[model samples]
Target chain A: MVKAAQRMYYGKALAKLAERKEIVVLDADLGGSTRTSDFAKVAPERFIQIGIAEQNMIGVASGLAAAGKTVFASTFAVFATGRCWEQIRQAVAYPKLNVKIVATHCGISVGGDGASHQALEDIAIMRALPNMIVISPADANEAYAATMAIADLKGPCYMRMGRADFPLITSEGVKFEIGKAAVLRNGNDVTLIGTGQMVMSCIEAAGILEQNGISAEVINVSTIKPLDSETILASVSKTKCVVTAEEHSIIGGLGSAVAECLSENRPTPQIRVGVKDSFGESGDPGELMKKYGLTTDDVIKAAENVIGKKGKK
Target chain B: MGGAKGLDVKDLRRRADKIRMHVIEMTSEAGSGHPGGSLSSADLFAVLYFHVLRHDPKDPEWEGRDKFVLSKGHVAPVLYAALAESGYFPVDELLTLRKIGSRLQGHPVKGKPPGVEMSTGSLGQGLSMSCGLALAAKLDKKDTRVYCLLGDGELQSGQNWEAMMLASHYDLNNLTIFIDRNHLQIMGSTEKTMSIDPLAYKLRAFGLRVISIDGHDIKKIIKACEKARSSSSPTAIILNTVKGKGVSFMENNADFHGRSCKPDEKEKALKELTERMSSW
Candidate 1:
């Protein structure tokens, strides 16, 4: 499996956007870790090192956006979303400013730094805000494309990326849109929905399910806020049962979004594969994924469980 | 810079008195608001709008206009009054404050009424925004200065300190922060609420040129803002003001910090301001 860190691709995308003078990047002393140093290397003048103050970083981004500059505020997911959630709500979302809060090192994959460093609830909180566009890119390629896409977009957006280098699932030139989901592989026996690094696990699970004569469809749900209900409904209408996967918690992230969409339109049987409303512990990234039930085998097990309930009363 | 846009100190005082009267009337009409802070900062707002700020109320989005952010946004009355008086909108619309479907929300919302620059109600956030606007102006090579007004009590939020460090780090010479040192918060005096005193020393330690002055003095306000504009780095102007200035019953009173005057109290406050206006 060819793996690439989404944060790396995000930095590359920012460096590529150096020619756009209106673009400004801000980081809160985590530039090297979050990879915004890539942008600073090229467009040193436009990149703002806002020290370790996430709340003030968001405020500065809001002011820059108000002054007609496209601002991308980058930091760890915990600080970017958790420490300054209200600042984002008041300064960015309320005004509907053109500030993209791209957070890196999301989910339990941020190992060794422990629970305090991991951000398992960012998706839920970011999704709750009005006028906020929440996205979780499936891979590094999609992260790069989404970075370019959001710069072209003019409003408040939150894009969450992972810490470890996950499998490259999407193609290099994947056309990323703000509110649309991309269907990766096609089948009929069951539907597999996933986001972030977990989407790769979903695709791998579909392959395993195919060997057992149970066909599975893979859908990468990157844009979590506007749940691309049309695409999701169309797949579930044929598949009848569903399994959702993500590196975040099962509460208000991708799992909850899919559940709400299905309950409203399709009423299909679904199993959500994510952290079970618990905090993460310090461990290897792969070990954390397995312990938290976010691995490919977990997706396969969820698929089997939901598929069993497909034909039942 | 010397006396304020050809308007003498007497004229500016009259303008401030009218703004204070509008604050009293608007808050009484809304039946709620932070009139104490609004009244305290009315003089600063008057000086900024009438004297120092380079703005066109007729063309609120004028490219060359300077930006002012009401960091302590609960004081919407003074900003609304100043904008209305400066012709951003009709003065009659000032009465619609805090009412449903009015652009004049309880707090200053950006683009709600063209003159309001940033949407600020949450404290300790506006200074960082002012830094952004100032940095952008420098990046864009515009001479536009950014000013922010904050409540002294709001300094406890910690985010303000973060912003102060950024301002000094970036050498945001185009930015000026006015700390409304009315010495009062909702609970009690700021000294008792949480000591942020030795305040000027703290600001200087944070790498700002701290200027302390009587906030109600129109000439001093104008001169301090002017000095801040030309500063080699960020400046903090400490405006020593009464909590509820001008109104004898409300001055230095914490109860009026977030309350509206009663009907008779409103009448008395209005009468006092009117008399002060007539004397000018």
Candidate 2:
């Protein structure tokens, strides 16, 4: 029922986007799950139903952008980024086209549909591109704001959203900027930087850490690329220990980006909690997240481990 | 409008001949370049730059200017010659065609080089990009048209069909596609390798206003372009052309697809081009 509510929220967001005449919605045949059906009904003329062709959808969006239309191209994160990577690189990122890619069903949360549906490498692939802003919003509200913000932005961006329902963490009317990080909770002992679905997990973990007398600074890093370097650097400088959580690969996702930033700007003890260089399997979203060490407990454990290492140093 | 017909067809022909000559020289200088496709599309480029397209050579980024995307990008020599002759850059810059630091890369680079709307070499993509540009112009209510040139061999890519379906579905009357149907590719003849036959019919079936003409004949090429501009639907003009139209030895030769002419061969090619120019 909560999942149904989340879908309703996405549908409402799509409806709001459709009301804006410049907003054009494109679907790679996954309009139902993506909740783009609402927008399609409201503005069929603005909606382009590109059937199962991810690469062409990206190119078409890039074309639409050239025509002065703000386009939102949606599909499963796996197919949208992986299948049409070259087109994104050439037509969108290389040309710096103003096209917002709304990639749904990201991470191991895309349950039952299994590893094939889950997108663990979407962040890695999108972040590697030159002029692409990668955003993995935490909840339906963040997704809504991210969609609207990216539309107004002048360059290409990839918005990663989850399939399963995520709890609404941030309150309504909260200002969301493209490159700024949201500091959810403040602490001095250890910094917990998280993105996407993991932001809610980190927030919960920060509460648990508080009970144990560890002041854990929880930062919701929505924008992965053009990262909030100022916030990350300041937090790491004060905390001296950092834990990055994400529903993505440990190799090149938010964790790697944070590690790279810390290693360069400030040398801090860091532990990355994510899907360990492995594929997800068929299971419930919660069970799969826990099994793959992507739960709130994992973030807590990672924070403790990094803090221990920081104390030794 | 009748005065456009009087706008120096002879001078346009001479420019096309010079572009063909430049393609031979540049390809020979680089020791590697596509001369065949370049020669075939020379007249099309001449018409686009000289008379047809509303492009300002001085301000390449003039937003009101019509867009031209060379999908078959290996034929950069022809584009370089035309851009240089049209005063986008100095004529001497043509010699730096494929040099390391040259803005004129082996393929066109958009925004960096004047007159090039999209940077393309990976085939089957230009048509899609052009479709976007045309679709964008339509959305903006701009009267500017988007033109894309594709090689017959490049048609082997599936992306072209995807773009074709979209172009037709949108009824992008502002977009005009020219296929340099020279029938020769790097390996061999297009038919011997992969038949793109009934090409005109296939385009028509995809809901395009299809036209067939001699790609090298300036008169027919110009006429087809004018007809494409007048059509209510997107146009796909198939230019039945020789791989290398000007050079006798290189004509219909697949080896000229990416091979450079030898020093002695360059002299012979230049001499032939000069004689043809004098006669004209």
Candidate 3:
């Protein structure tokens, strides 16, 4: 099967949801890029094109939410989270408005747009805001299900998606619950947790680890903020070591979230494989991932390193 | 629709003066609040809450009621005064302006007060939210109008301009934006700090129905509001007003923008407005 873009899945999900619910989709002049144009096509009256104004989009979404409309604000991750940080903080998060900020083209995968467009810190920024539910789907299937899940939950939510088209790891009938981690392939040597676009690589990394006599349990943590700590702790307590992978800055992405949970809860030795604390350059997505030490081999190496440190201390 | 209820200009003038008096007393009690900007927009708020706004004083959350947003949230004293006078809360509660336990927060918080529409302490955000409310009303096929009062100093934030453009672009005719052209910022004049000269032209260029009026004149404010309601585009009512409008010592004074009036200052200020009430 061909890979699907999570952003396209996001747009299709909104368009489908509009058929039943009174959904309002807002875009900051990136409807085509973010794939929200799909929603605009289906329901033009419900779609608001705000013309490159990210802050206004967020504030407007809050107002719509206050008026009892399920509002989905779409833009690139950088502008959706960073440019309109205060608006999301004061208007939406502080008020706990039922507004969904679903941003696409996250991380270095934005490719040629370079560091300016890459949103390496979006997860961290949104996660820090109170009353904000941050979710990063692993693939297009999870992205669709997650989009539907956020609509059902009333409150401020931030759903992050990548620009690249990735093959689906989760099949149909798989339950996608927020704050619940999905353990795809179970093993006992070490636990590998990944989020957003990195979970696909984690599965492949587990494949490589299996060849090396390392049995790895692959867990997909879609919801990063209200993290599935119980599921993660259960797996880590069994494996005694963990590997966290994400296509985001290593400082405050999935790795940081898992580290924060384990360092305080279980104290498991872990290896975090992600973008270093630096800006991304303009390059092909795959090339940039290899250059930034975010690949299948990187995750495999990280799993081995953590497995090696399982009983040393 | 809003009913005049046989209330003449005399009544509105008295109400405006009373609002100003409350602003002065509230700020004086708070010990650190914006009196100048509050006083400047008191007349606008008086006319809005008392006469023009289609709201039920008893039902502050009436879904059909017109929405008002104080985008220049620093001048929350006047909003509290108007809300108090309109029976949204106790008139005596105006003295608890900045008290920790009081619902009357330093800035206008939506749920904090009955009539307050939304929380807007940071400048340049209220208009966008107003536009959103107006847009939602349009989507619902309701004629609920939205009024947002902005301080000239708050226009320095770029987000206001972005909202201004979208309000015009989307043809948010249900939204009426009033810029309190008080000229004075907390530090100095708006021109000296960040020159937003050619203000009318800037708003007109954004395709709004621009109406410039004396912010202190109850009659002109009414007329401008009428013109605003009739326009097909979003209306920008530019109010030419003094920072400290009613008080003799505070008018056009930048120092009075954020400072509380001393006891002596409050006494003189109250006496000035109280004298205007006897004729009623």
Candidate 4:
């Protein structure tokens, strides 16, 4: 399978979006790694090099948005969400400014950078802010589509992407809509929900579950904040049990969102596959994913666990 | 309120006094708010609202109007007063400061009133946002100017230095920042808390055209703004001001920095401001 990093496609999208006169891109000294360097190359004048100040980068983005420019601020996920969360809350989300905070190098898979660089809590914190739309694309194609979609939308958004290349699950030129989840596969025994890179794991988990005479529904929950409760409830209602997978903490990520939704609508037996209240260490991406229980086998086991809980109930 | 004519120093002075009176009234009426910094920056706000800023109270969202960001947003009573007295809203609404459901939040909110440019209270952020506004104006080829007011105590936040570096790097000629050097923070004096002294030279070293002035001098504030606009880079005006300028009892008092006046103190403050108004 040909794999692609979501950040590369985000850069491609920025390069294409450079022609829009109102689009202003800002990067905090990591343009090359975050792929905003591509936008800088095309629209040198529109691209602002913020030089390692993530807080100032967000404030500048807010100001630009206030003046009627659609601003895109890019940085590593740790710096993008954690380093300057208050700036986004006050300047961007509070005023409902049109700033798209696109962060790369999210999750434990940002290998070798260790815990400080990995942003397992980006989804949690960004989701907590009012008027902030949180999105985590499943693959490169969806990342590109999400980048374009957020630019057209007129409010503050936080969209995260992973660092390493992953299998291309969605086809090229995939369409993305805010607050909408896509159903990748359908079944009745159990529902497997995932977001960001973990969506790939869920798809693979579904494949293995099918071979074992177990039916598993696979869902790609791209927008984590405005969770697509309708699609989620529909799948859970039919399957009666659900498993959520994400390359983030089990606390306040996609699993929490799904749990919150299901508990209110239809309480179902569920298991979460993610990092368990622990920080990551420097290692290879594959090994780190395995160590953190973010692999396809982990998702498969979670699905089975939830299905077992369902039978017991 | 003359924009094209000679500077109305007397009218602006009276406006500053009236703004100070409103600050006292609003905070006292609400029983809590920032008054010391607000009193210090009244003259600058008066001059900006009455003369310097090209803003219409009727159309705050007009594309051509110059933008203002109060980075030291705890002093929002002054901004609300300036906006109200300038006819952005009814003057009576100024009395509702910090009350539940009042549009006049203890800190400024962007969308609540038409004139408030950005929601700000967290320090060191307004300058960066001002840089963004200035950059956006330049990119659009609009001659819009951006103004930001910061607190001296706020310089302790590392983000302000980052914004200063950025504003200088981009050569944001259309941006002007005012530092309300009232010398006090919530705890105590800024110098004792964290020395941002040798501040003018430091700002100049950061690539800004630095101007130091008595913040209470309406004429000097206006002139400094004009001089700032003539420069080819971002200008920073350090306004040397007493913590509480107009009211005698509150002058240089750190307690007034975050406190409203009691009944006796409010009466005295109003009388002092009114006496000054009559003298002007």
Candidate 5:
């Protein structure tokens, strides 16, 4: 397992992206947290700090793409997806412009800033738009790799990350693809599909379930929009029971995407583990994750419930 | 320089008049379009397509092509006429202005229409997109320029100011914006609806090179485009124009802001515009 650093993982990812010549980073005044400050310091021309204007920032990124410049517009997930949604839809997605939107402080993990800063519904908002590729990297290594991969891609993409430090699950050598799912464990009793920070929680839950003698397979689905349906369907068809986890809301996020896939392709008993229909409040990241039922224990409980339902059937 | 100096001003003025006539006729056929703004912007559109903009209609996506965005997208009739006449599409397709499934949507849709840089209809957003295009050009060290035409009424939207702030901050000398100050929106006169009178001062304060001109004067519009290209900072031209300039009774009338001309009204409007063309 890759080791978790003290600073936010997104910051490290941005720093690594700055090294590439093709990558151009843009920030709408939230440079301090989104970790674009490091890129600005190193390569000033490559970094654009469009202070406090999310709409203009998105437009600038789109323009850069038109001139054959690969641009990454970074901001809080709330502002990037919510405030500037129309700009994203018109300038980037509809035109099929190649602009990478990196949204940090995603989900409730953006602790103490309250519900406004925490973007629980960003996934739903972005995924609904046509021609948009939605991705949530599990850790710093994955974020770095995803950032690099998306820079080379030729269309609009949304990259979601967290404000706080997250556990680094995979090492540098692990191959990362845009629309493919990553399988972490092998089991047949039930399948657990998770994304973003929740992938780590699923890894922990898989270990816990093994102790209880319930074999569980865990899949880390990074790209939420163009979901790897074949992998997900194959796992659920064999297991016949599933537990989906994400830091996003149960509505239209990773869990919803998984359910949509399963209901259509392969019908399976499923339990979705995420924030119930509610808002997040001020607290530590760990406390908020636990309170919102986004912990490893929550996943274990959700998995057990799905398995129990299967036994009853 | 020799090509521009030797160009026939009379022929260009005739072309602008033809575009205005088409703008009225097509809007009348569609039964819905902003003729007031479209007629007001006729000269500027004519100058850009005929002289100022460096583009090949055959190769719309050419890497070094200069970009133009109609921020005042309600005036799409003028743009469509220019694009169609410039050989981007068949000139006969002008009658299909707002027809269902036509490439020419009510607002500009990029990729559907050659020479269209971005899909723009929502007000105050085009300037932002233009800034992006200009900034990209600057980054790539490409000499290509970006011109955006904004409605005076659209200045009421806050996003335009956001774009203004960034354009000045970046010193995007490659970007130029034209404000079609026709003084009429859908409701009434711009002052009564939403005042943007001190438009030049606002643009100047935002650090752009501001030029106020007679919008319908093709020569003045051409000179302003040339001046904007020569300016060190990003430029903003306020084209003081009367809404529906050539058509009698519709001139300076707010009712024509988006109302289609009746069958009889279309004949009268066309006759008036053709007569106005004879004077040039």
Candidate 6:
């Protein structure tokens, strides 16, 4: 059975933490859509609904964090990361405050609402900021675990979540740690690195490649800012090739992160499979993913091309 | 040193004059700083650091201490001067404004200065931060109030209005907002550019108790601050001030908004404020 969206699990995590007595959740009037309303139900007094003002919401979250409250500021990814980018930089990131900006409805999976609502560049923008930790969980379970994990970690963080239901990939009690890669499936022909919703596709692509006897290693990169270079380098050094899949832009998303890591340490042949410098259009999420070159088929094809570049049997 | 019930008006005036002189010298030394806005807000800064705020200069992170957010952070020279003069740091450190590796950065950075409460440089964010702080203070059941200073130009940013609504909606009685109505921004007069005229009505409409005051008057500024503390709702004190308060050449001069005074202009400004310092 498919689980709820990552945002649903985020809200559930906060509800579970309601007894902790220090967690304060804020939303930019999009609580219902972002699923932060779940926390509002459990801890109404602790939840602050700042109406339609993303900038003020971020600043207020920073203030609460400064005053010793673990603050979670949530909204749609476009408004949370793009509209209030400067506010996040000035008030939250600069101070290195313990504020988690968990933005939902990220990427083309926020389908039919069109490009204006999709946050294809959040990873790049957030990672560029000093003292900002960017994370994109693979599924609902990881998002839930990441929410709990982020509360314990210090410093400003940007967590991106998607709109649609994600297939359950991780079993219960799978440990979640910031800046660490989870080796989902181990193999040797090529490394399949993915983040957010695309990790499911990378897993499927690895399975298909295994059927073809290509033996693709699958790694889920939940943390984007501090790219898990050690795991990617080790995997790529053994595989000698990589195919990075993400639901964001190919320009600066997980693909670019993997490429940057491999170029410095492993020097492996890499293929970046994502939205290639284009905006998403209104369509079904499945069709949009295929249109944007973020499908499992695309990752499998990228794996073949990259392995071919290695010039190995 | 700040153990007095309230600072005597004359002593506060002398301190304000000294602060104004320091603003001139520091901005002149920096060679590129906002002297006009700093000069305008010097009196209010004087009254706050010396009289109004409940802070320990030594224990800058005192939980019970009242917080101040320089919403109009370009006028950081005045805040820096007050912090130094109040012994939060060395008085001589005022001369190092905007220099490489100086704690006195071009804008008010909270951690760098012992008493600077929030980092502010980008306009229209401090009021929101103030509301957050005030809400927290109320949650902790402390009498600690938050004071945020906003510029006339900064009021144009829509985020300030958003913060205003939040403060009012939350009934953040512990927050006091001061708007420095200096009429001039770097571009030109606020009226010629984006006008914030009839600001009293706008502030009241936004659900704040508005109090108009002569910003340069130490006694009046102090009185309004007292009233803000006693108010049941969050207060917005409108400080009707000249762009450049103490200096003759710079007063109401848009040219002096962000640019530091030239050597001759700096000498003239110091000469005028130095004489007033002796009398006050």
Better of 2 and 4 by lDDT: 4
Q: Please, what are the lDDT tens digits per residue for candidate 4 over residues A178-235? A: 9999999999999999999899999989999999999999999999989999999999
Give a tens-digit lDDT track for model 3, residues B68-97: 988999999999898889888899999998
Better by DockQ, candidate 5 or 1: 1
Assess candidate 3 and give its lDDT: 0.89
Order the candidate numbers by TM-score, best to worst.
Answer: 4, 1, 6, 3, 5, 2
TM-score of each: 0.98, 0.92, 0.96, 0.98, 0.95, 0.98
On a 0 to 1 DockQ scale, where is model 2? 0.58
**Each candidate's chain A: what TM-score?**
0.98, 0.96, 0.98, 0.99, 0.95, 0.97
Preferred candidate (DockQ higher): 1 or 3: 1
Q: Write the per-residue lDDT of candidate 5 for residues A1-313, one digit (tens) a residue.
A: 4455312555566677777776788888878777778778877888887889898888778777766777889888999999999989988898898898888888887899999899999999899999999998888788877877887789999989888777789886556799999889989998999998899999999999999998999999999979999999888877889999999899989989988988888778899998897889999988999899999999999999999888554
CA-based DockQ, model 6 = 0.75
Each prediction's interface RMSD?
A: 0.5, 1.8, 0.9, 0.5, 1.1, 0.8
Residue A167 lDDT (model 5): 77
Which scores greater on DockQ, model 2 or model 3?
A: 3
Give the alpha carbon lDDT tens digit for every residue of A1-313 in model 2.
Answer: 1332244455678788787888888887899988889898998877887777777787778777866678888888999899989888888888787788878888898889999988999999999999999998877777777777876798899888888778888766556799999889999999999998798889999999999999999999999998999999988788999999999999899999998898888888899999999989899988999899999999999988888998575
What are the runs in model 3 whose C-alpha is more than 4 Å off? A311-313, B1-4
Q: What DockQ does every candidate get?
A: 0.87, 0.58, 0.69, 0.91, 0.75, 0.75
* Model 2 lDDT, residue A184, Cα: 90
Candidate 1, residues A1-313: lDDT per residue as tens digits?
A: 8999999999999999988999999999999988999999999999999988999999999999999999999999999999999999999999999999999989999988889999999999999999999999999999999999999999999999998998897789989998999889999999999999998898899999999999999999999988899999999999999999999989999999999999988799999999999999999988888899889999999999998898787
How does each model score on lDDT?
0.93, 0.85, 0.89, 0.93, 0.86, 0.89
Question: Tens digits of per-residue lDDT for model 6 on B84-151?
Answer: 99989999999999999899999977689778888899999999898888888876788888989999
A1-313: candidate 6 lDDT, tens digit per residue: 6666888888888899888777889988889888889888988888888998999998898788888888999998999999999999999998888899999999998999999999899998998899999999999899999999998987899999999998878876567999999999999999999898889999999889888988989999999888878888888878999898888888888988888877787677888988889889899998999888889999999999988889653
Candidate 6 CAPRI category: medium
**Local accuracy of candidate 4 as per-residue lDDT tens digits, B1-280:** 3355567789899999999999999999999999999999999999999999988888888877999999999999999999999888999999988988999999999967669999999888999899999999999999999999999999999999999999999999999999999999989988899999999999999999999998999889999999998999999999999999999988999999999999899999999999999898
